[model samples]
Target: MLGRLNHVGIATPSIARSIETYKTLLGADVIGVPFDLPAQGVKVCFIDAPNTQIELIEPYDDASPIAGFLKKNPAGGQHHVCFEVPDIHAAVADMKAKGATILGEPRTGAHGTPIVFVHPRDMGGVLVELMETPQEGAH
Candidate 1:
């Protein structure tokens, strides 16, 4: 079972601009900017929310996943909802067993985090991401 909605990933061409917009318009507080996984080609800034988070995702490379997405939709917007899961592998397995379509195998995400994506069709047209909490002392 899922624990809680961890964060909502927002695709943005200019994270700096987006951060300012969120701060001025939505009063979102910048929690932190973490860079621990260059392999993922992402630079992330976490913004706190009442019950979730606004994760600004800026692709470090043109080939980054988010970059490809932005190519199709220039004005970046809400990308995905990441759900915190106690066990990502198990959660993915369960979702698969229940006929959910998976986008990719479980793998490391930004900040060296374990993550996976379930296809939109599986979650009623909303792309969903599953991530395990960073193991204590890992980050």
Candidate 2:
């Protein structure tokens, strides 16, 4: 079951540029250090907000899926919205039973917790990520 709205994922060509924009334009602070997730094929940075965080993602390589997203959206754009789930396995099962298309199996996400994405078509044309609630003080 869904727990809470977690973070919004934004695809970007350059994390540094995006970070600067967030700071200068949005007056955002408390940005997390950018790190590469080779397996996920993205370089990620988190910009903390009052309620949730903004996940800035840049393609790690040409083969990264984010690269494809960037090709369609050269300036990059909102990629997905993540929601916290009490249990990823249960959430996956529920989604399946509800006729929602799961993008892939649950895997570790930027928050260092199990996550799975639902197809955009199945989620009202918006990609949805379901992440298991992180343990206290993690992330």
Candidate 3:
């Protein structure tokens, strides 16, 4: 079942520029260190907010999915919204039973937790990521 809103993903051409914008414009101060996820093909960083975090994602290579997203929106923009789930497998099953189109199988995400993405068409025009709730101190 759905637990809580985890984070909002934003695709960016440059993580460093995005981080600077967040700091200078939003006064964001709790940004996490940026890291690369070669398997996921993204370089990511998190900016902690009052309620949830903001996930800044940049393509790690031309083949990255984010690279295609950026091509469509050169300036980059909101990519997806992630929600926490109590159980990823159960959630994926529930989505399937409801006729939702999932993009792929659950895999480890930037937060070091299992995650799966639901097709945008199945989620009211918004890409949805379901992430299994992280264990304490996991990330």
Find the candidate with the highest lDDT and give its number: 3
Clash pairs of candidate 1? none
Q: Which sections of candidate 1 miss by over 4 Å?
A: 34-36, 134-139
lDDT of 1 by residue, 1-139 (tens): 4477878899888888888898899887756774534577777887878766788888888778788889987889888998878888888888889998888788987646789988888788888988887777643
Candidate 3's C-alpha runs over 4 A off are none
Better of 1 and 2 by lDDT: 2
User: What lDDT is reached at residue 100 by model 2?
Assistant: 92
- Rate residue 40 of model 1 by lDDT: 71
For 24-133, candidate 3 gives per-residue lDDT tens digits of 99999999999999999999999999989999999999999899899999998999999999899999999899999988889999998999999999888999999998
Better of 1 and 2 by TM-score: 2
Q: Please, what are the lDDT tens digits per residue for candidate 2 over residues 44-68?
A: 9999999899999999999998999
Total residue pair clashes for candidate 2: 0
What local lDDT does model 3 show for residue 46?
Answer: 96
The deviation in Å at residue 63 for candidate 3 is 0.2
Q: What is the lDDT of candidate 1?
A: 0.80
Task: Look at candidate 2 and give me any clashing residue pairs.
Answer: none
